[model samples]
Target: MVRSLKNPKNAKRKSKGSKKEDGSSSSNSVPSMPAKVWQPGVDALEEGEELQCDPSAYNSLHAFHIGWPCLSFDVVRDSLGLVRTEFPHTIYCVTGTQANNAPNSIGIFKISNISGKRRELVPTKTSNADTDMESDSSDSDEDELDNEGPKAPVFQVRKVFHEGCVNRIRAMTQKPHICATWGDTGHVQIWDFASHLNALAEAESNISKDASTVSNQTPLVKFTGHKDEGYAIDWSALVPGRLVSGDCKNCIHLWEPSSDSTWNVDSKPFVGHTGSVEDLQWSPTEPYVFASCSVDKTIAIWDTRLGKSPAASIKAHSTDVNVISWNRLASCMLASGSDDGTFSIRDLRLLKEGDSVVAHFEYHKHPITSIEWSPHEASTLAVSSSDNQLTIWDLSLERDEEEEAEFKAKTQEEVHAPTDLPPQLLFVHQGQKDLKELHWHTQIPGMLISTAGDGFNILMPSNIETNLPPANATA
Candidate 1:
């Protein structure tokens, strides 16, 4: 779902125009100012000197803001395969400006190469429009002429969706395009760079030479199945035009986009979770199956090919399950976190009719808010808690043969070990008075991003290092 972090200060002005006596005149006349375009990576920095920040100074602080009073950040690379300091390639923060009802106006900044200079990079507005156009055209021609390989990184701060305050934002893909999940007026909306005009110019340059496909400007699509607040959605990887969504009403609806310009409900309401389904994830390998975790203290697996009942149900927690994730690399693996101060991983293949448990984790003292599997490394899992710390686990280590034999022979009490070594803990920015949400960047595997309740600070993943090799090496 795509949502604009920028608040509309001119909403009243927009509303005022709607009240004009002559509707026809109002409709025909274009306003004096051009409509503000929604650009995701476009920066709002004030022009002039480059801004900088020190990563080491704040690295030890556990909690600190990179740019005071700025809202969003992202990370990207340049043509030489070098990480650019001026571009916030991974994270984004949304700080609402309180002036002129600009509760949604946001400042976008990026982490800098200089450790102490993680500041905002503002773009300048030039009156020489023709010159700029020529420059852009020349750049396009150069890109077209060169067949060196992958293109350089291009980043900008884009204003995606502007409505009410966005409660949650998740990326479905990465550039040459990106999609953001947004919650607005009890509906779920997905905004994509592919849907916007500003993105067309960028997309045209990025198309591969041997491709036969043409890009389409589909704008944004709104999914309104949830009568109340739609909480979560998972895009289908196997089936196109299909999505699974959960809402506050404890219902899960499967949707398919039909040829008639409307999304149709493909299945009946899949109901079983006693409370709100906070999250749902589709299995990367098993496209017909998916997992769902709810606030009702249960996790269930559903098969799209089957009927309404869950294929297998597990009452794996003592409290509300806040989040759930499927290991894209592991076909049968499922992870769920709960308010009971614990997280559990279950193997769908190991589930037996009377077995009450599979594998249990007790790491956090508070509810586990988010859990994700590392995209690059399958066995590595990242979990975040209300305690404001992120723990990374390496689950690749194999057990000793003797220990495995003993564990297989022992009872549940003897097999379960509570004193096992803790995962590597990386303390994220915690000093924020209120923490709202945390997410990992889909494109940049190791990058983590978080938002606070006041919408003040957005923190990027600590210890970020570029995987791109040095520029001088030939392909």
Candidate 2:
């Protein structure tokens, strides 16, 4: 279900040592290094001159240099609206396990904007030449922070925990301080990061330079039920401690946290799909409802009140539906991406037993790896295709009224018409290889992070300017 496809093509930090919760001495430091001198867009800045990013630049894609690369990752915004990026190590996984026999690690990076001055990142095109040159020198450069004014972008590595591949990570909505991680080992783990965040903050304020390693730090809770791995897990937004996970065995397990603070799993698995369950997403508004898509090319909506059978199921694609996302704005609106390089947006309210696709987008030439609805805008969502392009779609703009209405009116559309004119393809971002996931920053309306084989990208869509009215201006 969570497989990496082929090319498209597409930061350093410092550390210090301290004691961790597990009584292990480890290097505890957030990512910290002086900003690089290469102006984002070619010739955008002079030598020794700091970057003064335009306010509009925040609406476009800007790639940053995280010291390491990534395969899977998650972006979680804290209560203060600050964005934090968490992902397992890219090179460390291979070398650490093979060479040192060390457990895989997850790196926590906090993004900050210091804005007393008008410093911002310029829109830079990462050409092939620049990519080659920076590959060797960019990460290891230990340049000091130059006087770029107070508005420069800074990233701090809060902590790095010795763990596993961590194929997937999702932050809890009800308990923002907690997040869940799952991997190829078929283990699901819960982690409470409040104390770690605090410790990082204290170190930052005190400017601790001694590096520390967090070894054998255990998860808050761990559970295992699935015989096969490579599935998706989600925490219910409507119900605290309630979780639903899907696996390759076509089984869905429902879990609830008990009084003893441990998860309890149901003996009976929710079985319906003929193939592997690729993804599962819970209803933003309903506690008992959720939806799952599978390699069977079908998407099923399940209600916990019912037994293992799905309340509604539809043949969604010609190939495996690799991923599905629920529209945060419209609860019934759902989007699904398939291995056939196609994706569709469907209104579950108008769905029936047969093929129930509302609008089909076929721009992707490879498998669509990830699709996500924007938390700030109802009709806008972004999708990453294995073709190495991250395209943003806006359903509210320039849509054909007649076709949309006809598509919605039918209980089921037997044949999906090839989108004569594609839905408004708002923006296409480049410069990432094998892009796996894209997530809109919940606190920052226009910002979203993409994790891929090359590294991480913090991008602002081309149309983000529209979301930046005077009332919602951010730093």
Candidate 3:
């Protein structure tokens, strides 16, 4: 069974003001979120709510919710290079079934675009005779979501269909309607929503009596080369169909689309790491360059043309390196997370043949699972941990001389004082366990979404506009 929810009260709240220069709003007020009526761990829905029935007997119970991390910031350009204060009104969530079931799937959800203008719900008359009519009305609304962009803030589960259990799923920047996923199946699949999203939308909306019909399961493209199920996959930003994927077998493969609609793969996998290549990323500006982190506690940079050796390598962590993120704006800067529960930032220009880490973050108490650089700001980054928490870090904040002096007086930790202190932890998202991955919304600067064992969470810091300065203001 599947469930959907919406609170009319939340949709009617007005946006405070225009975005500020620094990407935050001048108004400091954070609109309060609706009270969570569904208690944690409860899978049942309230009365009057319709239950979506499916013969597959998939587990639909999960604790999914949203949160506010901060009140505000100034405005900045989005990943699309557009300056906007709002995010899209949809989310793609990868969901899984119970331990005994193999009902893995991805859900398309329509959510309130709370980052901008207040979107209100249309008032409807309630009548017992209108029960079936209401269901049809809901279907019609979903069809509109597929045909047109969001016109109002409507919270609903648009679709849920089976896809195998994928470890990572990423929507493309160049093509938002296309997404790529990889996992234990040793296959990297590319899905094109343009070919089927509208079809699914039309099928569901046209349902007069049946709502459980399954949609097509075919993917646009599939690539197989890894010795094991891939753990990481990324599409290049500068090049359209160029992609890279790594797996538990310590092998990395580069993929390109051929003229025949088939995938051309690197015959020889990029090899160097002694352990599983846990994560990989393509350089935003460099078409031929990419980076990968491994369980071997090392991070390596490779050029597609020269697969014989890494362009650069580092002993990044004391324990297994789980993930690494390239600074989108700062080409030479990168951040890495490890099983030791530490976050380190390094400048490739300054890294010599030594174990010199420029900065460290120690807030997470367990292994870090994911790390990402904010698309809007060069100095801002986000990370998730096995400790069931998501944290946002801003490197722009600097420690004063007094704090530096106090730290030196307190402990003689090293011969030389650390060059930089830990970045400021801007937000901490709790109440979830074993978070697997987290990502910043490309269109919305401050909004983020995360996936965990319990379910998925869409989080936005309160007063996200306050993070930026006014358009007329100078920073």
Highest-scoring model, TM-score: 2
- Candidate 1 accuracy as TM-score: 0.57
Deviating ranges (above 4 Å) for candidate 2:
5-68, 81-102, 114-152, 159-163, 202-212, 353-355, 399-423, 465-475
Error (Å) of candidate 1 at residue 414 is 35
Q: Give candidate 2's TM-score.
A: 0.72
By TM-score, rank the candidates, best first.
2, 3, 1
Writing each residue's lDDT as its tens digit, candidate 2 over 1-475 gives 4464221111111123323212344554533323321211222533323332222222323344443445556665455423222221111001011102445555555555422111122324455454333232112112233454122344455444635555677777766557777766787777777665555545433225322343456788776778777557788878888988888889998988888767788868899999988899999988899999999999999999988899988888889999999987788799999997899999887785454567889878788989999887888889998777788888877867796666555524243233443657766566577778878777656666787776666655334533443453222
Candidate 3 off by > 4 Å: 1-81, 86-100, 113-163, 199-213, 353-356, 399-423, 463-475
Write one digit per residue (lDDT tens) for candidate 3, span 44-75.
54433322211011101112432211101111
Q: Which parts of model 1 are misplaced by more than 4 Å?
A: 1-156, 174-184, 195-219, 259-262, 353-358, 397-433, 442-445, 454-475
CA lDDT of each candidate?
0.48, 0.63, 0.57
Candidates sorted on lDDT, descending: 2, 3, 1
Clash totals for all candidate models: 41, 23, 33
Error of 3 at 351 (Å): 3.0
Q: Model 3 lDDT vs. the true structure? A: 0.57
